[model samples]
Target: MFFFERAIAKQIKNGGGPYFRYIDDLFIVINWPVRHLLKQIERLNNFDENIKLKANIGSFTNFLHLYTENRDGTLFTAVYQKPSYEPYYLPSNSIPPLHMKKNIPFIMLLRTIRYCSTFQTYLSERENLRMASLLNKYPNKIIEQQFNNVLLKFNIDQPLTINNYNKYRQNVLDSPYKEPTGIDYDKVLFIHFTYCSSMEMFPLKFHTLWSKSFGESPINEITPVLRIRNVKNLQRRLTH
Candidate 1:
């Protein structure tokens, strides 16, 4: 990908528009004429037998999860989901870390806010998110609180103004993502299981056994953490 991108970067830059790529997905905004651009793409596809380019030329397009379009002279963007996209989330009543449940709404809202250029678009996506959360058995209070927290963190007011939206979106783009902290794999032990009401005391029993079995050994120094490998809902099961 590095070599392939570099090969075409010069031409794209000379086209006087922005170009972005994340892994194999490429989104290019260029001013080349239709025939010229098609011809260029044809050459790129034939450049390698293993690589093929599928081009869509239009005023509106979807790339990755972003729906971008030209509205009058301005470019607008919103969340893009495929026709088969389903609103599936981790069921609130299911087993998982509390942090995962809490993080879902806030993180999803942040993604929606970043992609939506207008307040109306953000509201539309927010409403969809609210519905999805409800279907996944999440309490209404939790969703409301998470959404409020996101807006508060980004310094956005309700019924967002055009003036405020511009600033809010800028902050989203300008903010740098956090680097992942390194984990000490040797000092930690992970136990994966599917939780049920019957096994409520199993964790405590296991810990007690661990202390008794390894109390005087060096293994006792390691920490044990429980993890739910995965939860299969109807939608995921059907799809898989």
Candidate 2:
């Protein structure tokens, strides 16, 4: 066991009774982690056996609660950390239970990528392919298609030809215009092409997976407890 777990176990034995444990989130809101807590919970469950764990993480929403104490006459009630906007605490007049609020966007392809790095590692290639395909299929979708038209108007049709791809690339790279306009449009096309192609390579299948699971790929809903836990970890690191 980790030192924190051991220390918590010892604290439970010496001080407060059983504690609330969030296994997946790796958080325990107990003053002392009692070694026999699981056994105790099981015994309690026998009396009122309707409770079921919501996730691998232990929380009141999943199971029952028990009471514990502190050295300074504090009442340390042990309950799994229920998903909430605020920290879990006793229902004193000052602190009330905060129900969780969910807000996630669909098509947050960027956000979802952080969880599994497999997609991020190859994002550039994915985006490039997406852009290339998009440009090939939907010429109108290119932000700077007008540039090609302008070149054509100047009777410079060779630049856009497949055989003259390198020449076209060189003209765009060397062009002084850096924006999406008749004068300087390749910049816009290049950027759009890069991301569109990269995203294509990145995989729309993953987006479909997210959509299937959450009803939408762009907007999503995640465990609020997890979001809070992440914020708390960040705060701790910053403070430390």
Candidate 3:
């Protein structure tokens, strides 16, 4: 992927438009004629038999979960969900520990913030999430409080700044564990922590037992695990 991107970087830059790619997904903003764009696509496809380029040229398109519309000279974007999407969330009464339940709303809200580009979009998506919660038998007041808490923490105001909004998301989602600088790893002990209602002592004991069982490497070599919940797939159901 790196080599292919490098090979085409010059061509794309000289094409007189913006081009961005994430992994294998390519997004090109072009002002050229359709025929010219088609020719370019054809040329790209012919460049490598193993790599085939599938191109879609339009004023509106879906890319990486964002629905984008080129209106006049401006671009408008909103969250895009597949037609088969079915909203579902963790039920309030689930058997998991209390901490997991507490974390659920904040995580969901964080995702809502990341995906929705505008306040209206956020409200619409949030309402859909609330409806899902309702289906799961979560209390309306509790859900509202949780939503408000997230908004308060983020200081989110109307007419959102999409770019700046995402900056603090990682901090909200994951607590950092600094790895030691110098360490040799013979074996890696990975501790996966999820929300637990129990006191801090519970994790401490669990960590002890885990270390006893697997043995521990120096903290420096251990990579901190950051779990970011992705509800996109959970939102969809198979249409059978």
Top candidate on TM-score is 1
What local lDDT score does residue 167 receive in model 2, on the 0 to 100 scale? 55
* Candidate 2 per-residue C-alpha lDDT over 1-240 given as tens digits, one digit per residue, 9 for 90 to 100: 354456545655576555555552222344323545565445533543443322222322233222233435542232222345232222212111122111111111122222112323224423443354343342323313433344553346653444553454345335564476363332222211222223433334554565578685333544111111222345558887
Candidate 2 wrongly placed segments (more than 4 Å)? 1-37, 54-105, 108-111, 117-240
Stronger candidate by lDDT (2 vs 3): 3
CA lDDT, every model vs. true structure: 0.84, 0.35, 0.65
Residue-by-residue lDDT tens digits, candidate 1, 50-146: 7676767778999889999988989999999999899998888766655678789989998998999898898899999999999999899999999
RMSD of each: 4.4, 26.1, 8.2
* Model 3 TM-score (2 dp): 0.57
Count of clashes in candidate 1? 0
Clash pairs (backbone) in predicted model 1:
none
Per-prediction TM-score to the true structure, in the order listed:
0.72, 0.17, 0.57
For model 3, residues 1-240, the per-residue Cα lDDT tens digits are: 667677667777887778888778877776767888788788878877887776677778887777888789876666788888777667777545545666677767767766555556777877777888788777888877787778667564433344554444444435355697753344444444554334335565765665676465555455333232222343335432
- The number of the candidate with the highest lDDT is 1
